[model samples]
Each structure stands twice: as C-alpha cells, then as structure tokens.
Target: MATNFKIERRSAGGVRVLALDGYLDAHTAPLFESAIQEEAQAGNRRIAVDCTKLSYISSAGLGVFMSFIEELREAGGDIKLASIAPKVYQVFDVLGFPALFDMLETVEEAVAKFAEGPREG
Candidate 1:
C-alpha cells in the first residue's frame, strides 16, 4: 500500500509547531522539509516538531532534520521534537539524533525549553 504523510503548522506560546501524522518516508519527506524551511525563512526560529501521530519514518525523513538544525541554531533558534512514538524514537536513537538534538515528552516541554534560552553548545 502507498504511504501517507501530513504536516500541520501552528504557533503555540510564541513558538512555531509542526505536527506530523502518517508515514514519513522518501516519498513524503519533502513535505516535512518544506514546512521547516518556510518556518526558518520567515524567521520563526524557535520550532517544535510534534510527532505524536507519526507511524513511521525513513532515513530521508531523518535527513531533513539534519539539514536544517545548524541553520536554525545559527539564527539563535532551534528545532525541538516531542511526542514521538517508541518506534520512531528507536530509529532516532539508533542514529544518535538525541545527542545532536533535543527530544522532549510534549510540545509544551519543547516550547518551554526554547524559553529557557538557547542551549549552551
């Protein structure tokens, strides 16, 4: 069967949030990448990517995150992830993403982290 993916963008407590649902594979990774790019281009630097409904993710999906993180951080903002299901987290874990990025339990937590100030690199 063909996979499905969607991205919904919103702002919560002054931070931009991208909510993802469905499979995130090569076929659908561009959608996710575009969402992030638009947010950054608009200078909405602080972002929270909510993965609560994401059912699957391929390396291509993961690659999009890697592509934008530095650009966001350089702008004094960052992309934080939250509400990821176990399977997705495992994929991230195996790729050591948690070390290169921040992962929290909720979009609220991720947004709150941004308020705490830019992470000390």
Candidate 2:
C-alpha cells in the first residue's frame, strides 16, 4: 500500500490553505482530488496548496489540477502553490507548469496573496 498523505486546511488571512504532506502519486492523488472536490462543493474556493512536505508527484496528480483549474477559476476562485520541493519543481518546470499556475516559494508569500490581495512581483 502507498503511504498515507496528510491534508490540513485552515483559513489564513481570508484564503483557504491546504497543506499537503507525503507523496502525491497515482495511488494517492485520488485522496487529494476528493479533498479538493469536497472543498469546492462546500463553496470554499480560494485554495492554496502548501507542498512543503510533499516529496513526489506523478502526472496523474498534475492532471487533477489541470482538470479542475477552469472550474475553480470560473467560480471566482483560484489555486496557489507554495513551498514546492526542487524535484517537484523540476517536474513542473519540465511540463511548463510555471506558466500554468501561481507558484510561491514560501507559505508566508502565499498567505499574503489572498484572492483579492495585491499581486507579488
């Protein structure tokens, strides 16, 4: 069995912060999908995925976001990523994901950029 991951959500300065721990690969991506779906269903749209402890991510995990980005955006909400590991960042960079999403280097930075907050340079 794959290792279980942890998903923690809390309201941070008006945005929903989702902190993820462990790997986000084929078997574990569904757990993440369900979490995001549940949150969306509840009308909690402003999402931030804090991946400080996420060690790995497969293509299927990437697809979860690719498939939901539009839905989230249409609802006047957005997804932000923070604390990406270098390995994970390489995967995203190789796939041109830096152009596809708002990625931050730290959790503090993510909290500062709430949905309606000022853009960071």
RMSD of each: 1.6, 2.5
What is the per-residue lDDT of model 1 for residues 24-103, given as tens digits with 9 covering 90 to 100? 99999988998998899898999899999999998999999999999999999998999999989999999999988899
Task: For model 1, name the residue pairs that clash.
Answer: none
Error of 2 at 73 (Å): 0.6
The Cα local distance difference test for each model comes to: 0.92, 0.84
31, model 1: CA deviation in Å? 0.6
Write the residue-wise lDDT of candidate 2 on 1-121 in tens digits. 5466778988887778889998888888898899889989999878889999988888988988887778988787778899999998998899998887889998778777764543333
Choose the strongest candidate by TM-score: 1
Error of 2 at 90 (Å): 0.5
